[model samples]
Target: MKILTITGYKGGCGKSVTAIHVATYLSALGDVVLVDSDPNRTSLSWANRGQLPFTVVDERKAMKVVQGRDFIVIDTPARPDSSDLKELAEGCDLLILPTLPDIVSLEPMLQTAHDLGEANYRALLTIVPPKPSREGEAMREELRSNGVPVFSTMIRRTAGFQKAALAGFPIRDLTGRDRMGWLDYDSLGSEILEAIGR
Candidate 1:
């Protein structure tokens, strides 16, 4: 099984949202479980209310339950300490660090990447503006210039995300105006699966 941890040193970077959406997409391929490591239990609460297709469990029993699963998408806490980050990285196949296209988010993301020390990780741009601004592209360039591998697919900022979270539905399950949000995550899921050769 591949353990994919969605983490960042800062909060409000779409970590839980990415974890839920990605887990939903990956579920189509194989058995996928979302492990909520955040003390707030945001993803677990959403799962409990939304009745997501896959299972949702707390961190306490995550390792044991993920033994035979195809993917373990972990929603980690915000701003984990260095030791905690190290422990979380252990045995993880991929570390997905989602960041906003701003200096505040990018700075900490870079620091977190440096602390991890050569682990398999990729930085994903989240909350990008919908009007095709250069901000997202610029942020990707900045990260790449700093030696951080970044994903070309970026999660755009949309009310659809908030709607999905509030209604307990995956972005892909939404219809009408909110449905466009699924495309970004779908691209991200495809890239991740391809990168890992799954």
Candidate 2:
């Protein structure tokens, strides 16, 4: 199985949300399982509250169900200690770091990147505001100029994602405007599949 880990320096950057959606996309290819390593059990709770296409288990229970799955997505606690960072990078096929497009997120995200020192990973910009707000594009350009590996698809800011989280279902499950959020994740999943297949 290809193990993908979603982590970040702080909360509210869409780590768990990204993990769940990525796992859902992978389920299309084969069996997939999401392992919630966060002490908060965000993904696990989400699965418990609503119906998800794939299985979600706590890290403690993961070993039991992970076998034979084609993909394993992990949601890790924010700001893991230094040693844990190295171990996590070494243990995963891809390390996804989700960050908001703001100074509050950059410092820690840059630090995490510097600490990673060439680990196979990509930085995803999430909660990006819509037009008239240039934060998302600006951040993506800034990161690219610095030679950081970043995703071209950004998870735009929308109440749909929040609603999905509350209802414990993927954004696609919701009708109307909420489905727009699902499109963003679908683009991200396409990008991720390309990255991993390389």
Candidate 3:
């Protein structure tokens, strides 16, 4: 089984949202187990309301339940310790860290990546505004120079994501081929799968 863990040290960086969407996408390809390791149960609530086909396991029992699954996606809680995060990372074939393009998001992301050490990892840029502003390209370059492996795909900030979240469905279904403002995550899934050789 290929395990993917969505983890971050800070909140509101699209951690839970990324977890749900990735799981949904993976389920379309094969058996998937979505483990909401976050104590807040953000992903769990969305799965419960949406009635996703994949199973949801509590963070406490995730390791055991993930044993025989073809794929496991771990949605970690915000504010997780480095040691605890490392434990989760050990099981993942790849660690996905989603963060905004701004400093607030990048700092924690960098820290988490360092904490993960040799764990296979990549960063998905999220919450990027559509129109390029003064901080856009520069920030992207900055991330690359910092030795962070960033995906070319980016999730543009949009109201559609919130709407889809409220309706309990994947935004890709709502946006069709247009990307629904999440350009990065749309292709990011494929990049992640390719990285782990899955």
Best-performing candidate as measured by TM-score: 2
- Candidate 1, lDDT over the whole model: 0.88
Greater-lDDT candidate between 2 and 3: 2
Tens digits of lDDT, candidate 1, 1-198: 888998878888899999999899999999999999898899998987777879999989876788889988999999888888888777588888899998777778788878888877899999998775889999999999999988999999989988888888898888988988899999999999976778
Q: Counting only residues 3 or more apart in sequence or on different chains, how many pairs clash (N, Cα, C under 3 Å) in candidate 1? A: 0
- Candidate with more favorable, higher lDDT: 1 or 3: 1
Worst 10 residues of 2 by lDDT: 103-112
Order the numbered candidates by TM-score, best leading.
2, 1, 3
For each candidate in the order shown, give its overall lDDT on alpha carbons. Answer: 0.88, 0.88, 0.77
**Model 1 worst lDDT window (10 residues):** 82-91
Each candidate: RMSD: 1.4, 1.1, 2.4
TM-score for all predictions?
A: 0.94, 0.96, 0.87
**lDDT string, candidate 3, 6-81, tens digits:** 9877788788888887887788788888888687898777766666657887877777777778888988787778
